[model samples]
Target: MKNYLRLLTHVLLISWCACNPCTRVESVDISAGVLLENGSVIYDGLEYPKSTWYEELADELVKRYGCPCIGRVCMWKCCGPGQTPFNGSCLDTGLAEVNPFNPPVYRGREPSNITAYGTFFYMHGHPCIDSYLVDTADVNEELFIQENGTLMEVAIGGTQWHLPTGYCVDMKYHNNSVAPRLVAAVCFPEENVSTDDSPLLYIAYAVGLLLSVPFLLATFLVYAMIPELRNLHGMCLMAYCAGLIVAFPFLAYLKLHVGRIGVAMTGCLVVAFIVYYAFQTSFFWLNVMCFDIWRTFSGYRGGSTNKRRDNKRFCLYAIYAWGVPAILTACTAGMQFSDNLPSHIVVPGFGSRRCWFVNWLSEFVYFFTPVLFLVVSNVIFFSVTAHRIRSIRQETAILKGAESSRSDKLKKDKQRYALYLKLFMVMGVNWTVELISFAVGGSNWYWIVVDISNIALGVVIFFIFVWKKKVRGLVQKRFRHMLGMPPVATDSRTGRWTTSSAPTEDTRISADETAIRLKDMH
Candidate 1:
C-alpha cells in the first residue's frame, strides 16, 4: 500500500511539471539590461522604452567602436549622412544645382571623370537625382517621349541632358529670363519603351499584315502562270508583290520578337537588312512601273514586241530596282557598324533599339528621305503621263474616222493608265498617312485605322490587278491546259470568255506574242 502511494505521488509530480513548463527557467546574463514582455528594457531598476533604449545604445556603440547599433545589433556603417550605399561605395544623394546664367558646371565630377558602369555611369545632376547617366555623345539634343513610348529629339535651347534609365526631364529655358527648374520627370524602362505595345494593337497589327499574305501570293502566282501577263508592266507588278511578300512576314516577325533581339543579335540585324532592302526594292519597282508607263505614253517605242529587247529592258530595270536598295542597305550596315563616323552625321541604329530604325531622326535620314524622293519622282511621272493621256485622247477623238485599230489601242492604253493611277493612289495615300502619323508621334485611333489599311495593301493590289473577268478566264484556261482540255474561247473585243464559237488562240503562245500583248486583258 505504501509503495503504491509513492508511485501515485511521482505521477502527480510529472503531470504538474508537464502542465507548468515555464515554471523552470534557464539563467542568462542581464547585467546590461533586461527586456520585459512589454518590450521595455530595464537597467538600474529603471524601465526605458525599447526605442529610447535602442537609440541610446546605438549612439554609445557608434561613439565607442565607430559602428552603428540598431535594436542592440552592431552593424558596419558604410555610408555617411546624406548619402546612400551603392555599387560598393557611398553615393551622394544630392543633385547638382546650377544657375543657367552661370557657366555649365558639375557639382561633383564631370561625366568623363566618373567611372563607367558598363555603358552607363552616374553624375551629380538635378532632376535625374542619382539615376544612371547617358553619354552625351549617345543621344541627340533634347529628349521627349511619344505616346507609343518612343524617345524623341527636340531642340530646347541646345541644352540637353540624358539619363540611361529611360527617365526624361524637361529642361526648357528661355535664356536668362527663366530660372533653372525641372519641368517634368518621367521614368520608363528603355527596353519596355521599345518593345511594349498594347496587346490589342499588336494583335491587330500582326493579323492585318498576315491577312495580306495569301492575296499577295495569289497575285504573284497568277502573274507567273499566265504567259499573256508577262509584259514589262506585269513583270514590274510581280516584282513589287514579291517584295511585299518577303517584307511583310519579316516585319511581323521582327515586331513579335523585338524584346528578345538585343543590340548585338546578328539574326535581328540580318532580318532588319532584308526587310529594309525588300521595302526599298518594292518602292523602286513601283517607280519603275510609273516611269515605264510614262515612257510608253510619251511615244518611246523602246518597249517593242521584240523578246530580246524587252528582256534587256527588264534586266536594266532589275538592276536599278534591286541594285540601288542593295547599295543603300550596305551603306546602312556600314554606318551601323562604323565607329569612325563623325558625331554630327547620325548613323543608322538598326538592331540597337528594336531591329529597325532607332529614332525618328535616324529613320527620317536613312529610310524616309529616300522614300520621299521616290514618291516625288513617281508623282512627276504620273503628272506627265496624265497630260500625255489627255493629248492622246484628244487626238484619238479627232481621228476617230481613220481606223478601229487606233480606237482599240487608245482604249487599252487608258485601261493601263487607269490601273497604274489606282495603284499609285493606293500606295501613295497609305504612305502619306503613315508619314503623317509618324510625324505626329502617337497611336491615335485614326492612325491605327490607317495602319490596318496599310497592312491590307496586298488585298488592294490583288483586287486592282487580278480580280477581273479576264484574269479569271486566264486562270481557267491555264487550269484546263494543265488538265489536257481545250482552251476556252475569249471574245476578241471584250477579252472575256464566251460560249460563242469564236476563233481562239492556243494557250502556248510564243515569247514574242506574249511581249506584244502589253494590255492587261480586262
Candidate 2:
C-alpha cells in the first residue's frame, strides 16, 4: 500500500505538471467587423463592458464614420501614468495617455496636419497605415476631440482618421479644411506575427528538417542491419529517429499552410494527431533512454533465470513511451471534437494561421509540462551516470594489478563519456534552447539556433553511433559480405574484421558488452 501510494504520488506530480491537452479552432468569422451589442462591439464573441476603451473607440468611430467603420476593425494603443508618450503604452488595455503606440498614419501628405504631438510622436515612433483621412475642420475647435467628455485627437487616413480615442476615432470635418472622406476606425487585436516570412529563416528551418531526415533514415537502416547495434538503446534511438521523420515534414506543412489549418476539420485533426503522437513518442523514447542509463549505473537488474524479464521490461517501455501520449492526445482531441471547451482556451491560429493550442493553461498542461519533466529526468540520469563512472574507475583501480587493465578501463570510460556528452548536446541543448526561447518570448536568433540544433540530432547520433572508426569498419565488411565480395581478413581469436589502426577485438568486444549491458538494464 505504501509503495502504491508513493507511485501514485509520482504519477500525479508528473501529470499535474506536464499534461498538455490538445486544441482546435473556434467557429467565428473574425474578418467581419465586430457586432455592436448594446453599447459595445462583441470581439471574438466576448461582450466588452459598455464603457471600456475598446467599446468607446469602436462606438465613437461608427457613430461618426457610419458604415465604413462598421465593417472594419482598428488597432488600439494606450498609456498609463509615468509612461513616456511615444515609448510606452498599455499592452493589455491598448489605451494611451498622450500619443498612440505606433500609429499607422502616414505624415508625408502635402497638406500635413503636422501638429506638435503628431510630428514629435512620428519622429520617435512611426507606425504608418497605408492611408489616413484627416478632419482639418476640428483643428480650430480644439487640438483634441471629445469622446464621452474625454479630450483626444481624431487623425484620419489619407483617403480620411486612421489614428484617435481609446486608439480608434470617428471623423467629422469641422473646418471644411479637408473633405469628410469616410474611413474605418474600429481597432481589432493584431494577428500573430510569423517570422516564416524571412527567406533565411525559412531556408534554415527547411534545410535543417531536410538534412535530418536522411541521417535519421540512415540510422534506422544501420540499426536494423547490424546485429551489434540491436540493443535496447539502439532500438529507442531508432524510434526517436522514426518520430523525427514524420514530425519534421508535418511541421513544415504546418508552417507553410498555417492559414489553411484551423477549426476541428477532419483533415486538420488527423494531421495534428499524427504530429503530436510522433513528437510525444520521441520525447518518451528519450526519457526511456535516460532511465535505462540511470538504472544501469544504479546497479538494478532482473534475474537471468526469469527469461521473459528483459522482454517484459522492453514491452513496458514500449507501452509507456507510446501509450501515455496516445491517451493524452486522444482525450484532448475528444474534448475538442465534442465542442465542449471553454472560450478562454483559444486554439492557436483559430482565426489566423497554424492550428495549435495557445492559451497558457493548455500550453502548460499539454506541451511544456511534459518537456520540463523530461529535462529534469535527463539531468538526473546524467548525474547518476557520471557518479557511477567515477566510482567504477576507483574500484577497478584498487582491484586490478595490471597497468593494461587500468588503461583498458580508462579507454572504455572515455569512449562512453564521449558518446554520452554528444547525447547530452543533442537532447539537452535543443531542449534548453526551447525553454530559453519560451522565456525570452521568441527572440529571432534563439529560434534560429533552436531550429538548427533540433535538426542536428539525427546527424549527431549517426556520427557517434554508426560512423565511428570501429563501427564504420564493421559495417563496410558486413556490406561487402552481403554483396558477395570476398571476406575481409579476420582476427583469428575474436573473428571480427580488424584494421591495423583499429582497437584489438578483445577491447572492442569489452566495450560492446559494456554498452549492451547498460541497455539491458533499461
Candidate 3:
C-alpha cells in the first residue's frame, strides 16, 4: 500500500511539474490601440480597410496611442462590461478581462524604467475608465496621476491584487473625452501582463471527459451485469457514471462550439441546464457514496446487519441526488425565461453562445452552493468514517489474540486502510480541490489540479473497481462460457478452479485430488 501511494504521489508530482507553466506569472505586453494614417486604419502594422463608423473610431483611437495592434483591445472594453463583443459590443474588451480578475490593460511601458502609460476613454455616458494592474513588488508606492485635469496621488494599497501575490490598481478617469486621458504609473515588472491559452485547458478538459466515457460505460456494465456487484455501493457507482455519461457529451459540445455566433438562445439554455443537472447529479451521487460507506462502517462497528437498510436508504438518496438537481436546474431555466433579468444574468456565456451560468450570484445561489453543501457534509461523514475504521482495526487486532505479533496485525490492517483511501479518492477528495478552485476564482494552481483530477475520474473508477483480480476472473469465466469451453478443474477444499488434464471421479476435482493422492501414498 505504501508503494502504491508513493507511485500515485510521484505521478501527481510529475503532472504538476508539467502543468507548472500554466501557473507561472507570465509577463507579456498586451496592447490594444487603433492607429490611423492617411485616412486609413493601421491594424497589425498595416493599413486596414475602412468600414463601420465604430471601426473608424477605433482606428482613430489607435492612432492617438500610436499602437498598430487593433487586436490588443481588451475584451471588456468592447463588451461594455458583463458582455462579449460578439453580443453587440466592441471587440476590444476580450483581452482586457481574459483572466478571472480582469487585470488592467496598459499601453507601452518604458523599457529603461519602471514607468508605463495607460489610456482610458469615457464615452456613451460611461462613468470612468478603470485599469487593474497586477502587483509585482512589496514596496509601498505612490503614483502621480491627472484625473480630469487635476493631479492626484493614487495610492497603491498592496503588493498583490486579487491573488495574494499580486496587486491591483484602480485608476478612475473623470468623464471627459475632449482631452486624451493618460494615466502614467510606475510598475516594477515594467509591464503588468498575463498570457493564457485557455483554449488548451478547455481542450485538455474535453479530452479527459471523452476518454472517461468508455471507461464509465464499462464500469456501468460491470456493475449491472455482475449480480454480486449489484449492491448499494455498485448502485452509487453506476449512478455516478450514468451522470457523467449524460454530462460529458454536452460539455464537449460546448467546448467545441464555445464562440460560435447566433446560437439559439433556447438551445444554449437547454444544453446548460442538461450539463448542470448531470454534473450535479454526479456530485451528489458521490456524496451518497460517502454517506453509504459511513453507514456501513458504523453499522459493522455496532454489530448490526442491515441488509434491508440499503434498499430503504437508496430510495432516499436517489430522491435527493437526482430530484434536487432537477428542481434547481428547472428553477434556473425558469429564471432565464423571466423578463426581469438581463439575458446574460440568466444564461452565462450567452454572448459567447456557450451555455453556462454567467451571473456569479445566480450560480452561487443555484449550483455551486448546493454542491458545496454536499461536499461539506461529505467531509464530516468522512471524518466519522475514518474514526470508525480506526476503532474497527484496533478491535480486530485485539480479537486476533496477543499471540499474534502487532506487526502482523498492522500488515493486515494495511489492506483495509488502502481500501478506505481509494474510496476517499474516488468519491469526494477531488471536489474539495474544486471548491478551492472556486475560492481562487479558477485562476490558480488549484484549478489545474481540479481539471486534471475531475477529468480522470472515470479512469480512476475503472482501475480501482473494474480492473481488479476478481473482476477479471468473472469476465474470463463469462467469456469462456460464451465460447463453449468446458469448466476448468476445481479444488473441492478451496472451491477454486484450476488447470488439470487427468480425469477422476469428479473431473473438476482431479487437479487437487491427484496431488492429494500422491502425497498420501508418499
Candidate 4:
C-alpha cells in the first residue's frame, strides 16, 4: 500500500506537469471606437449615453451589412418589411442581415448634424449591404462596429458591425492605448475553449487499463500457478509493476472526470512500479541465468529447484533496479535538466516512455543497466545450451551415435531467442511510434499510429503465448483457476489431483509442487 501511494505521487507529478490547459489568449488594450448600446460613440472626447448623431449613423449600417457565414443570412430585407432588431438597436446584433436593396444613408449629407462621435458618407452607403464600412478603418485595427458587442478587426473582406456592451474581440494585437477601460463581464476563467475532447485519448486510456489488470493477474498467476513467473527476475517483475502503476492514471480518467484526484493518482503509481520492477527483474534474471551456466547448467534443474529459497537475491535485484528511477524521478521532478530535454508539456519526439532504464539523465540506469542484463542473460542462456551441445557431442562420439538431441536443442534455443527479441521489440516499436507522434505534427495521425501499435502489442503477446504449446497449456489452467473453476490435472498418474469444489488441506503445496512439474510434458 505504501509502495502504491509512492507510485501514485510520481504519476500525478509527471502528468500534472504535462497535460494542463493554462495558456490563455492574451487580450491587449486598444484605442478603438466604442459605439455603445445607447448609440453613443465614446471616441476621443465624447462620453454621452445616447447621442442622436451616432444613432442615425448606426441605423444606416443596420440597413446595409450582409451575413458573412451563411453569406445570404444578411441583415438585409428582400422586401420592405425589415426584420425587427432584438433590442430595437443595431448594438444588439453585431453583423446581421439587412435590406440589401436599400441605399445606405450618411448623416454628413446633412453635415450640420455631424459631431465628433461619428462622420457619415456624403449620401450613399458602402457597397456591403449591412456593414458600417468606415473609410477611416485601418488594417487589423480594433473597430467597434455592429456584428456582436465586441470590437473586431475592420477589413474590406472581413467586417464587424455591432458595438458596445461586451465589446467584440478578434486576432488583432495592440501596443498601447489611452482609451478608458471596458473590462470583462466576469472574474472567473473558462474551460475547454473548444469542444473537442479527443475521444481516441479516452479510448487509449481505457484499452491500456483493461489489458493491464487481467494481464498483471495472469502474470502474477504465472508465479502462483507456474514457477516460471516467480522465477522471473525481480527487476523485470518490478518493471512490469511500474508499467501497471503508470497505466493507472490512464485507467482512472473516467474517475478523474468525477473529481477524484486520488483515484487518478493510482494510475500513475502503476506505471512507476512496473518500471521499477522491470529493472530489478532484468538484472536478477541475468544473474540467475549467469549463475546457472557457471554452475554448469545441471540443465537449470538445481536452480529451478531452489526457486523460492532465492527470494532474498531477487528482492535485492528488484530494489536496485526499481529504486534508482524512483530516486531520480523524485529528486529531479521540479528541476530543469537540459534545454534539449523536452518537458512534460512538450513530449520528446525521440524519447522513450519506458525510459527509467534509458532516459536523458537515467542513462546509467537505462543504458548500461538493461544492456548488462540483456547481454549477460543471452550469454548465460547460450552458454548453458552450448555446454549441453558439447556434452552431447562427446557422448554421441563415444557411443558412435548421432547428436540429434544437441541439434534439436540448439534449434529450439534459436527460436526462443528470436521470440524474446521480438517481444523486446514491442516496447521499442511502441515508444518509437510515440516519439514520431510528438513530431510529424502533434496531430491525431501520429497518435493514431502510436495507439494502434500499442493495442497490437497485447495481441502479439497473446498469439505468441498461444502458439507456444507449453505457455498455452499453462495460460489455460491459470485462467481457469482465476475464474474459480475446478483445477485440471496435468499428471495422469498422480491421483492426488482432485476436482472438489471445496478447499483442500495442502492445496497450496501440491499446486506449487506440480507447476514446472509439467515442463517435461510441454
lDDT of each: 0.61, 0.51, 0.51, 0.37
After superposition on all CA atoms, what RMSD does each candidate show versus the true structure? 15.8, 22.0, 17.2, 19.7
Please write out the lDDT profile of model 3 over residues 1-522, one tens digit for every residue: 897667556655755654322212221111243535544445445444332112111322211122222332211122233322232223322232322223333222212222122332211111112222221221322333222211222222212222111222322222233221222222222123344334666677788889888988998998787644565666777898899989988888776654442333677767777888999999888777777667756765322123356668778899988998888777766665544343224333332213565335546666778877887888787788778768767666675675343434344234434554575665566766666556656343446766777778788878877887656655555566568775344477986777544542221222432232110000
TM-score of 3: 0.54
Q: Write the per-residue lDDT of candidate 4 for residues 95-205, one digit (tens) a residue.
A: 222221222222322223322113211111111211211222233223332222123333222333332221211111121232112111111001211343455565665
Flag regions of model 2 displaced more than 4 Å.
1-200, 260-263, 300-309, 342-353, 359-361, 399-418, 489-522
Candidate 1 residues 373-401, lDDT tens each? 88899999999988987876666775567
Top candidate (lDDT)? 1
> Looking at model 2, which ten-residue stretch has the lowest summed lDDT?
20-29
Put the candidates in TM-score order, highest first. Answer: 1, 2, 3, 4
CA error at residue 451 for candidate 4, angstroms: 1.8
Segments in model 1 whose C-alpha atoms lie over 4 Å from true places:
1-197, 300-304, 444-446, 491-519
> Which structure is stronger by TM-score: 1 or 4?
1
The estimated TM-scores of all candidates read 0.65, 0.56, 0.54, 0.40
Write down the TM-score for model 2: 0.56
Q: What is the lDDT of candidate 4?
A: 0.37
lDDT of 2: 0.51
